[model samples]
Target: MKIAASLIATLALAATTIAAPDNKHGNKPNKPIVINKKVLQTSKVPFIPHSGTALFTNWVGLNVDFKYVKPVFDLVNATKAYGNGTLISRGEAHITTIPPTEYDNILHPAGVTIEELNALAAKNNRLQRARFGLECLGRVQVVTKDGVFQQSVQIILKNYKDILSYRNDVFKLFVKKGGNPALFAADNFTPHITIGFKNRDIFIEDGVYKGKNACIHPIVAK
Candidate 1:
């Protein structure tokens, strides 16, 4: 009778052990169940151009007189930056009026139509009469993150406040029209013309060049 009772108790214990939840695979140990409430953004974001040929965006600025800067380019070709017998001769030089950044995602938000922007662009065309000047200071070189030296020009522009005001007003309207507000540079905008992307050793003696009325147009993205 004692053997029988012992076997019955052992079977009961085994049954209880098997029936209990397995903590490793099924139930967590006294932990509250967590559910993620945040939704992941799945929509594809827009592209913003930083450097190079403004490929995906539009640009507006004053057309440079290539004839005037030819000598400077000749000097640049002789520098260490372009010493590989490479010469830069045929890129448009212009003071950035409305940078490529201004047009990125300009029509993303609701209610802002391209027609409105085009109308504003028409008003801005009056800026075609705006005259400015640039004084090429000297060579500017910086060690890139890849440990290679990169160089470009250090230039100063006259009547920059007017440009800034125009940029600010356009940015405000863009935001009010539902464009992204974060893309605009409301302050701390430095106006500099990029002479070369890889060569910084080229130097042009300090000189002031006056500009005629430049075109101010709306940049359309590709």
Candidate 2:
């Protein structure tokens, strides 16, 4: 009787083991669940040439189409009562790829003339083919040519991978021509289009006037 009972107990134990839920193949503890996010499509803004003087003759930049940025200017102009500031003319809009100081200190010393640099940039077919996209509008305080702090409204650029890559290639070209790698160190380049400058006291947040002088309408890219 005892032997028979022991055999039955062992069989029951085996059945329980077989019936148990197998977690070895299940999700591991503390593992993060990844969600695939959808990429938003950006609207295309067309470019139209406008006649105006360059803000900095010594600075080199990629010219932006004025028609692409006219809406922002119009919005700011409509809300000029919020604060007094000068709007950047259509011709002044550009993405500054290289600053004036860098041209004088780095490229010139390395025997990389502006003409040669332009020729190299022109050869970059990717830049010519890529279309520009609007990212967002933001307000920042910038120093004017006269060395005074002025609040400026700027259009931050997006889909600018081609521009950034071109700048890196330009640096590499200079370095290949015997430029110092240490002097040509990477900079925190924020490619933006300055629309206008306003009084320091005026509060413009993310391209909109805020607080007492708030704008009635929000700035739209269209």
Candidate 3:
């Protein structure tokens, strides 16, 4: 009886060991790796508040495919408090090709409307079926209409040669059509998608609020 009991116990132990979940085989989903790092402000241009109507009346950009950014959205959701910002909707995510600052110089002065620009972009051979890769995360500060500064988190993009080329082509076309080139000349175009914005003023350089408050660090997920 003792021998039989010992064999049965051994069999039960083996069964339990075999049934145990193994993380190495990916039986469980891997948790996102979150890192807190000090990142410099990449752009000198002020962040435009899309919620406001007066400043951002019209802008040109290429819509980003959600599949390539879903993981980023997931990461945003996972680390919302760390970012302390509002999440941008999936449908609204895009890479800004031509900012509103150039509207007066390129679009309006050139007699090219937003609808017309869209049509042109649709027919462009290079832009057709083109996609950009996500490079990294960046943060910037935007001066609001009230002169208050707020922090914004953005996703920097890579593999944007086609987009850059298209932008230059548009600029040249506008300039040729008697549009003012002053604003375009001074404009520093950085192709990125703003993912979220924090309401409170956060110093982007040191990631602190007004240099006295605690720092709300930007979360990087991998």
Candidate 4:
């Protein structure tokens, strides 16, 4: 009877050890990775307070083309059958900084109409295009809970600091035009090019494709 009790205790200890959470990747076992699927819902403009629901596009961002990095797209597309295909256009990768809700609050107070906002975005694009561009480093694979995965290309701005300066300068312009500078979040920005999103964590072959190109267009209300 003593031997039997010892075996039970040993088994319980082993089971508890096995059930302990693993922190190999620094992610907590129960914490979820929330992938932004906002782009998928393009038809309806997401709701914003104190703004008229005029069917206006919710966000404006910098559109970087993949002309120099077409091979990366080819690889992602070839492996897309496993789960997800490319959602972004072959022509441009959207760089979201000023999200719509905040943008509305920034502009509406200043009486900046949609047409005027577009014009400002276009002007900012032109000013930046004359100075710097973006570079593609390679592929970055992200594996989430339940084995869901996503592939994206790492993008680096050639003059990131300079571009940031430009963003600040443009924010000043908007503020002068009646928008709020306090609404901008400069700390939470990251630069990357998303290739595709997957439903399941299926292993897709990862590879590197290298190139650099000038980013000319900044699409607003698009």
Candidate 5:
């Protein structure tokens, strides 16, 4: 609540700011348009409000195996199986190819960062590598009482520094502590839409694949 209130206040300040008028007009119009943060927020109230102390719950999201771009990969898998003579399908049907679209958000178009590329290059005997991370404005993953899993990764304004710091903290906490760790990532930041989730206790201190399912994405880079 405190954090949310603070953010709201900050946003309110920005909302109230008046843009300087252009001096090109000889009349020098001086009427300032005042913006009401409250009205703006109210207007956009239907959007998910993930910020604020009590409103957001953060967790260390973990996924051991992620079949990213599964739809595309599924097609490729079929081709490989057919070539290997395992599929044994010689049908006259043509392969209907669908051009990739933006629906698959896993493929990062921003490309790899210099730091990430360097990290991989520093390791010897690696021919190719891709390092990418996402700062989405959506809901974080959560587990329901019925064992169902949910995901939310909207295009929320992400804090890059905080995320990097969180990654480090996640590493140290999970690696060094070797016990139950607390995760407090988002705070009334905001929410857009529910993305997806693997819905499993990922960070098992003493389990295979670090106790995370391979199909889930990790809160921090693994």
Candidate 6:
């Protein structure tokens, strides 16, 4: 009798797992409670791109030429922040725009989609599933073009990955211990960078997102 009960419980667990999203690989109905991985994220998110690629998220033409760029650069140069006289600030961050051929009309740039994400999981032999939520301003205004927009750029922060900060808001929402990417089951803190020419999505005063994303200033060289 006990053996029969154990078998029944196992079958029930297997059924539940099979109902979840199917993995990319061709696996026979996976067993239940199959998700056993964590999400990875980090704190101190990286900065935005330099002037060269900053236009990736902006529309065709917009007005976003920041005049203070030179002065700020001067201040950094005048300071002894660079002991070796090397300009490392430029290497801090970058935002490269994918060609339209990748993902044409999507609101945001080409990132790992649900399909690709699933495939990655299979390739890495991941069965447990989790999600992280983050966003990038879809468009921005260009100072030069007057009324152009830039494409949105957002990265999908997933589970079983390493995170910089284990205590972000999204991680708190789903993860318990903290935002440490190493212990993530599912997280939502998406470290993102957006390029906008004249986007109002950013909060100039408060210095945060007017809606769902944070403000990113791309300090590029002329």
lDDT of 2 at 131: 48
Task: Indicate the residue-level lDDT of 150 in model 6.
Answer: 20
Deviating ranges (above 4 Å) for candidate 4: 1-58, 76-91, 124-154, 177-180, 186-188, 199-222
Q: How many clashes in each candidate?
A: 1, 0, 0, 2, 18, 45
Could you tell me the lDDT of residue 57 within candidate 1?
Answer: 48
Q: Could you arrange the candidates by lDDT from highest to lowest?
A: 2, 3, 4, 1, 6, 5
The local distance difference test score of model 3 is 0.49
Deviating ranges (above 4 Å) for candidate 2:
1-56, 80-90, 124-126, 142-149, 198-222
- Answer with 4 or 6, whichever has the higher lDDT: 4
What TM-score, computed on C-alpha atoms, does each candidate reach?
0.48, 0.57, 0.55, 0.44, 0.17, 0.18
Residue range 1-222, candidate 1, lDDT tens digits: 998777666654553443332335422213221111110110111112223334434544444444444444444445443223343444544455554444444432434443444444346353333444443323343343333444443234444565566567667776776666765665535454444444432222211111211111111111
Name the top TM-score candidate. Answer: 2
lDDT of 2 at 140: 46
* lDDT, candidate 6, 186-219, per-residue tens: 3322333232212332222211222243222222
Tens-digit lDDT string for candidate 2 (1-222): 998777666654553443332335433222221111111121122222222234324445666555545555665544443213354444345666666666777777898676665665555333344444555554544333333444555666566776777778778888889998878754446666666655442222222221212112223342
lDDT of 4 by residue, 1-222 (tens): 998777666654553443232335332213221223332222222221222455335554555444433444444344332113453334544444344554566655566565554454456353224233344333334432223334444333444454455456556766777665676644334444544333321122221121232121121111
Each prediction's whole-model lDDT (CA): 0.40, 0.50, 0.49, 0.41, 0.24, 0.26
Q: Residue-wise lDDT of candidate 5 within 1-222, one digit each (tens)?
A: 998777666544442331121235333113321212222122222212111222112112111111222321223223321111122111111100100121011111223122332232223312111112333212233333233332222212223343243344333433343422232222212211122223332111111121112222212212
Report the Cα RMSD per candidate: 27.1, 23.1, 20.8, 14.7, 25.5, 24.3
Better of 1 and 2 by lDDT: 2
TM-score of 4: 0.44
